[model samples]
Target: MNINDHNPLPTYHAADNRYQEMKYRRTGKSGLMLPEISLGLWHNFGHNADFTLGRKIIRRAFDLGISHFDLANNYGPPYGSAEENFGRIFKKDLLPYRDELIISSKAGWDMWPGPYGNWGSKKYLIASCDQSLKRMGLDYVDIFYHHRPDPETPLEETMGALDQLVRQGKALYVGISQYSAEETARAYSILKEMGTPLLIHQPRYSMLDRWVEGGLLDVLEEKGIGSIAFSPLEQGLLTNKYLKGIPEDSRAAKDGRYLKPDQISGDKIQMIKKLNDIAISRGQTLAQMAIAWLLKDQRITSVLVGVSRPEQLDDNVASIKNSQFSDSEITEIKTIIGA
Candidate 1:
């Protein structure tokens, strides 16, 4: 059945067939299994966005078997707005299914003013987690991540804080994001000695970016820690959005913070066009192909996706349908992306 077929209802009753189409992958050695396509609140679920539209998109996602919802403390434009918004939606539509969902949040990066409000210090990570729980109206988050590594703070201290959170019951499991191979290994070692094995790692990976491939994936394999890739679309560059020059409303045109106008060079556009051809031959959109490419590696536990609307989820989730690739297609993709 089409999960997105219905209109607004006074109450939200999730589809009984929600788990039929979507696939679930075991998260490393953990008992937890995450959806192949998880929803992220990194964009368009903030104070700047329409509340009703965001709610509709989230409900639609759950209907399609997306049980994981990813968020960060500073996700919204105003910082914490996304969690506040998710709190409202949880109370209204998803509270009943809370046990069936895998909800995660992160800390690190500049969140509030002053030194205590940022970084990987036990103070900041602990305080930020408390604030996030209050904002999201939850007793604990399923997974709490140290969003990025801190140079000043010792790795032991940071991982200790995560261990403390798990022990204290503020977070069921702990993970890290954006750490290098050396750092991931170090963090894993520290957490292992502390008896709170690092559950997963979140990294920015895509056809356009392959930094994680240098050494991180190998480390994850050796250590038996799972990985979830963010930015699998590379800020929408891998999609058909920029095939005919940047639109006025495109992310590159408006959000200069991440996807800049200068980054989309003439050569880049040509490469995207070539990739689009490959996707067409495979009967999938470029976005779908990009996501499917990442999942081809069994080391990648899941691919985190963000969408401005619910309809976008329909296409992204379908990536699992045709994840297989011929050797020739793989070689062609490698030659095109220069990876």
Candidate 2:
């Protein structure tokens, strides 16, 4: 029997109408459907965070119709702690509803010290998926991704491992994140020829950062691979929190690891305040506008959002309610963004 079997916890029956409000979009041409707003375990579900709070946030996300939970091998401050903690909760709270969830993990960044630990290689990819499954206490993940491209490793070998995982019953689908448009095309061709089509691509996209717009979106569209926008708020740059100045507890201030204080330049702050005004005019927060803006592009499968609190989930998910943009509204937004 599982060690957690004896531990008592609050009952977490999902909301009956959880699927009613939220819309599901097909990932690429595949049958897999993901919620419009998927929750990411990149920030709050780490080791140093409170376990109870993590559980609460997860439960709230589920209650709000978020069935997809994204994770990575190097997500935690201490590494693997998010998955370790989530595994405990899964065994306890979400075990019975396992079929209702879509869990994904990646392994491209530096997950360990050794040279073999990081990057995409046949051995490293396979081993990292196993480790991730073990940490999440799952038999298989819905989608296992190559976190990033490895210029060192041959694409054929990396794609082969992903294909092998699908055939090995370790992963239901495979994806790539942070690959360039050309690289994504090459991967898609290789994977398709190998008889294991790439399902989706995750890219860093927001009003502040629009690199994906150049050709990435078109590539995904032509290739029939879905795209999920990560950091859609640009590490909170597109939000009102940084309007006046960075708060002491803001991600830029506290988590200098990825978001830095210097990154918040004066020009960006002026742009954020302008975006905030538009958000207010639309009766939504700047964060919501940023999210809604991403969703406006039909090619985007979903906007992967990271929330520190349950209320933030409520706000982000609400963006879907008014995601439509008028001709002039789009023009105005693009003008302000200098697009």
Per-model CA lDDT versus the true structure: 0.93, 0.89
Q: Number of clashes in every candidate structure?
A: 0, 0
- The prediction achieving the highest lDDT against the true structure is 1
* Per-residue lDDT value at 223 in model 2: 85
90-204: candidate 2 lDDT, tens digit per residue: 8768998899999999999998888789999998999999999999999999999999999999999999999999999999999999999999999999999999989999998
TM-score between model 2 and native: 0.96
Query: Listing every candidate in turn, what is its Cα RMSD in Å to the true structure after a full C-alpha superposition?
Result: 3.6, 2.6
The lDDT, on a scale of 0 to 1, for candidate 2 is 0.89
Q: For candidate 2, list the clashing residue pairs, or say none.
A: none
Q: On residues 249-333, what C-alpha lDDT tens digit does candidate 1 reach at each position?
A: 7778876787776668889999999999999999999999999999999999999999988899999999999999999999999
After superposing all C-alphas onto the true structure, candidate 2 shows an RMSD in angstroms of 2.6
